[model samples]
Target: MNTTPSMTLERQRADAASARRPEPKPATGSFQTVEPRLEIAPAGATGGELVDRYGEILTPAALEFLAALHDRFAGTRHELLAERLQTRVDAANGRDPRFMPETAWIRDDASWRVAGPGPGLEDRRVEITGPTDRKMAINALNSGAKVWLADQEDATSPTWANVVEGQLTLFDFLRGDLGYTSPEGKQYRVTAEETPTIVMRPRGWHLVEKHLTFHDRAGRAMHASGSLVDFGLYFFHNAKALIGSGRGPYFYLPKLESHREAKLWNDIFVFAQDALGIPQGTIRATVLIETIQAAFQMDEILYELREHCAGLNAGRWDYIFSIVKTFRSRGRRWVFPDRKAITMTVPFMRAYTELLVQTCHKRGAHAIGGMSAFIPNRRDPEVTERALAAVTADKRREAGDGFDGTWVAHPDLIPTARAEFDAVLGDRPNQVDRLRDDVEVAASDLLDIPSIGGEVTEAGVRDNVSIAIRYLESWLRGVGAAAIDNLMEDAATAEISRSQIWQWLDNNTVTAEGTRIDQTSIVRLMAEAVAALPRFEGDRFDDAISVFRTVALEPEFPTFLTVGAYARFL
Candidate 1:
């Protein structure tokens, strides 16, 4: 402890010399090797502190591993790690079916009240007939569609005259003077006015190859940039530029099948937004759910780009074709009728509707029903009234069944459909109450019994049978049909009742042997059922029962019954 300064200096010099000298090599048979040690700070410690602490705990071998980990997690590199983790999180959450339920909880709460008024028919459909008629186009726009699809997809001619004229006319509508004709053989003139209702559906993706032309104002041909040759690119660029000028049309996204396809569109939208200096959410999109796969995975597709999606539409004809094509390979194994003869009451249609309603409601979206293809016969008052009446009835039924709105093919049908929806849903209680109750009942543990065989007694079965038979009888006779509580009957009881009825038919238990078990008989039976139920009221339920009975009594019913009977026989 009491060393002289010269002795201390000599000791330090000896230590420095020792540090500079090379370390001794290990012997071939040596057993002593240094092991690495690592130190980890508490979870919340800062990077610098953690690094210092880690250095303190690390042996030579551990220092290398710590340096690698630190380098991987540092600065811009950390964002890459975060992205990888986020991707894993997305995959995990996306795979969970329960994720939708949790995500939809807020929507479920908000949709509890019946949907309020939305952008009406005046906000959804537009018609364009002539190829280059700007006046006609402007007049059509007067119909007031929120977004108009100037359809080069289906409505335009394939000739160059038509195509160029159409393009020029569209330009004129946006930039040049437009002239109008009055009823009294007078002409009215107006200049170009910016309108939001003029989206163009360029010839489809497959047909773009046929429409490539590169020419300037001098009518001289110019070399086409391979990128500009694509119709999608051209349309995208021009539309984006027009949008920058505050005159662009929102896109009606077509032919999307997968979430990847949606993301592709989202990418394009993002590009357009950045290039045009437009706000990200300013451009709206309505995805056409036409393909079978699109229908099933629509929720995922929408959720992927929910910020960009305006809404979705039920593309009926394409959907019908999709269904037939999708199931055609299954051959006779499928029980459904030929596609042409199938009605909306079929199970397929029911499933589609259910899925559509659920998806739209879960996203706080407007559930617009399919179009009525009926046209009015205005010459005959009776025919017109009947058509209007039929449309009103159909729309009312759809609205009552929980659709927010519907589409009509003709301009005249729009007002009627709107009126029907307004009449049905404007003042009524929301349908969400029933959905909430059902969800609650389904989730309750008390209702989780495995089987009803021991619990359902003979007396209980007999009472249900008796009630069902009486209800069926009243329904068939069409007596007091408006008073049946059809929803209160369980599926088991309905099956038993139908079984008993068939048994009676088979055993010749009824007195009228010659009376065929036809549609009429089925209708009467359902009417009887409605009459027997005490809790039900209103003609609305009766109407529903009538429709259901009609469906049940179709010729297909017998075919279904025969199949079931034969299967049981085997």
Candidate 2:
């Protein structure tokens, strides 16, 4: 692998900063012993601005624990990220992906099972998904779902305030003191039946949380992994309390490409447990198999994290995004139709879902299904009704296919999802007893992309452009999840939207309407889309347009659109 000149310069600057920084002083609390040369940067990618509220979570002990985690695992994380690039290179060179020969024994063995769901995780029939902003957090806690996926990954834009305030939200909610007072002087509080088990989904391994910098004694400094910062801060402050409440520190691990990445998380779990005096297996994790490479190694990923693993999640959006991304440079056969045409019942997607259910059931883990983007609209009854029907049908298929639970983007769809699972799993925690013996998904079944049988259309092209521009606009303004056309658009959706355009342009794909999707078509459609969107004060559409072109129109596609966008404009 070769390093770009810009990347090399960035590394040199980080190393220089580490050489000049003094060692951090140890202080009081449980994390006093674990100190490194870690310090908070003056500002973040959103630029040099830190609010007074950030001080609540940036105490000495929390910084120490986060530093210790980086000191131990940052090196391995760097290596694994390099390995991800190698995997891509190998695939591009016609090294067809198959089940890993090295970890075949784990797949063949039948006796091994992941640790069962920890307390409060036994029945996850319906989980609400949203960002950890105060309003969203309050809604999810009382949404009547079994679990709340407090997402910081795809659904969150990592502004420094978002990063630190999310940790504080978790800490305060668990202790029953979380509240919000609006500018109009109204008070809101967390009120509910057993507050849905909070499973925080940190950012993936590829991202660097620029707000926190790790300076090691080895005279090296860099932005810390977003994954470790979210995990470390939450675990440091709230692990014991969660355990005392019989609900351990649960997590939803996202964007794992192989078993090696899973193993890295397993090692972190063991170390964090030891560091905090929590029992082994006290932390339960549900891995989201959203990437194409990860699909081929589902069994091995579970095996690596078996000691602390809970289950796997199928993502209709991100999985499709991964497919387009992994094979982006291939021929027209690998190209997909409009985003609307790539439904869940498509051949490749069905095979992925069936294999996920079968593999998880075989290993005695939950088979959680994908999330649908059709969020309900309270202002319009017709839209809400349409969303209910779509959610019901999707959740019904998942439950019938033997999924234990499913993800809903809005609270209004919770009853519809739970009803589907309730019908299939009456009086039972899960359907893991059914091993899905009838499911036989070969490597070809998972990779049968040409069998997707759909035509690319001009409307599809315009839709993709619209979604990309609108979603990126929201992201640039410090928002990760945006509602567009009754659908919740997040980073995953933006990736698929842009990657599809990049794919179509690369393959010289001709739409059914006899239109070639080139730069001219994109620019025209982008202007119309931007005009259609209602503008507000301080909107970042101009910057969003720049990001869209950089990620979608460039000859060379960046790995993840968020990385480049974060670098240039928050």
Candidate 3:
């Protein structure tokens, strides 16, 4: 990391300013200085302007340090840069803070409850009608799921109408409408019976209490939970109501990006509990470690919410995007494309699973794996069996790898999946015991390269960097065409030589509707670009590319893709 002459001078000035100030403080009126400050300029800025801006906010020393850092980063491979940045951000956030010294969270002999004797599969059952629809609601309830996500997110069509309807349905289900039955030769009917043990995934942070268009029995307009409302509020408001009515539906928290974010959620849950007059641990929170940053700090995150957090679950589609975006620079090397090939059996995944299990066991929590998004075709037995087999295999692997349970997309796959998990997990030691031995390692050590096994390869690094750059470049160019190879090229490569053309287009980036570049459009455009890449020459390449594209285009695509894209560029 070499500092340019100008940067060096800037650093000196920043150092002097810092020394004079003694204590760091946020800039405020009157106290604000005209002196240069260190700032992260948006990526498209020219070197001269960037330097000039650096002089304005940063003290001499700060400027020099930043410049030196910038020099070190300049022209470096994307993967290396990404790794360094990831490391830097981790350190800054105190992500690996040491709360205790050399005390393993999981003891070798410690044990916890396993969800099943073998592999256990939980399917997500979504209800669209309002809670008042006991017949339909109970049907979903009786469908047999280890977990049923009462979606307030994408599953519902029109936001306003669905929210109130969904909430009411939940209320009824908890109260008494959940009784259902079907005779041997009869169609399934709601018989007012209730079944215990179904987990709920509430709507996202979109809609909570606004009035919507659900009609009452008389068919007149009535107020209900709207689509565009905050899900947290909805859960907070209804959790007690449902529990008071004698139904316990645990929650699955979604879209979390970091441990800090998880902590924030814990805080929110606490606030909700207090406001609702519920006990602190009454509402169990499961944090979705879906982002790249979150994946790296799983242990700390789990620790942060030890008391309130119920468990952790991997979000496969989101996690994949997180990986791609987090390490996009290395996408060209086929690491990301060949992720399935890498096998969840790899040491890195093992480390993650191990940490997850360790963290959960330490806190007496459940460690759950995410869903296998396999949609079975009931008409086609082969397709159904294949789907079931894939899910069963995943559950077996997860249970063997120490996950207590896993999720499935369809109800039909649940029985088999659960059976598989139950078979493997029968009377095994809990994950807590395993993690107890490793808890003695410092937080930093837990996240260090040694704990994760080998250093990230150059090819891996490059792929991440390339993917990120190409995605961004394609986004800027209104054409929505991301070149996979562009990320692999250095300044000396032909691809790099042609960078200006794309940069210019990106600079003038606009939407098909001729609107300014918004984040949503940028994401959609990036996916299109990535998808438009020339298919590579291999059987796996076709499938990999298709999977990548399909996952990118899914409704939840935005949550993961944006994070993935940002991880690379940042």
Candidate 2 clashing pairs, residues 3+ apart or interchain? none
Which lDDT tens digits does candidate 2 get at residues 103-211?
8898899999999799999999999999998888998998899999999989998877688888878888888889988889987788886789989999999998876
What's the residue-level lDDT of 337 in candidate 1?
A: 24
Q: After superposition, how far is residue 156 of candidate 1 from its true place, in Å?
A: 4.6
Candidate 1, residues 1-570, lDDT tens digits: the string is 112223334443443343231122232454553322123223331111323222322234333332222222212222322332332233223221122354354334442332221222223322222223454455445433234455443334233334344455565455444555767876744433524355454442212222222222223222221111222332433455555555444555544545555665566556556654666665556566755556656666666667666456665544554433332222222212222233344445545555665666566544556554344665667766766876777677667656655555344566677676666666542232223122211111211112211222223323433444544333323221111222122112233344333333222222222343333455555555556656434333443443333323322222112123212211
The positional error of residue 544 in candidate 1, measured at the CA in angstroms, is 43
Q: Which numbered prediction scores highest in lDDT against the true structure?
A: 2
Go through the candidates in order and give the clash count of each. Answer: 19, 0, 75
Off by over 4 Å in 3: 1-139, 154-158, 178-198, 202-233, 245-249, 330-335, 338-343, 427-570
RMSD of 2: 5.1
Global lDDT scores for all candidate models: 0.41, 0.86, 0.42
**Cα miss at 265, model 2 (Å)?**
0.2
Q: For residues 1-570, what per-residue lDDT tens digits would candidate 3 score against the true structure?
A: 111223333443443343221122234665543322223223332111223222222234433332222222211212222343443334333334233323245223244332221112122221111122234456556655545555443233222223345555554555554343455544554442444244455443212222212222222222222211333334543566656654443566664554555555556556556655777666655666655456656655666676565677765545444444332221122122222233455544555566666666665566777665455676778877777777777778777666666765445666776676667655553343444445333334323322222223323323433354443343322112222331111111212212211221223333234454333543454455456566444323333233333333232212222223222221
Stretches off by above 4 angstroms in model 1 are 1-139, 144-149, 154-169, 175-207, 213-248, 333-340, 379-386, 424-570
Give residue 287's lDDT in candidate 2 (0 to 100). 96
TM-score of each: 0.46, 0.93, 0.51
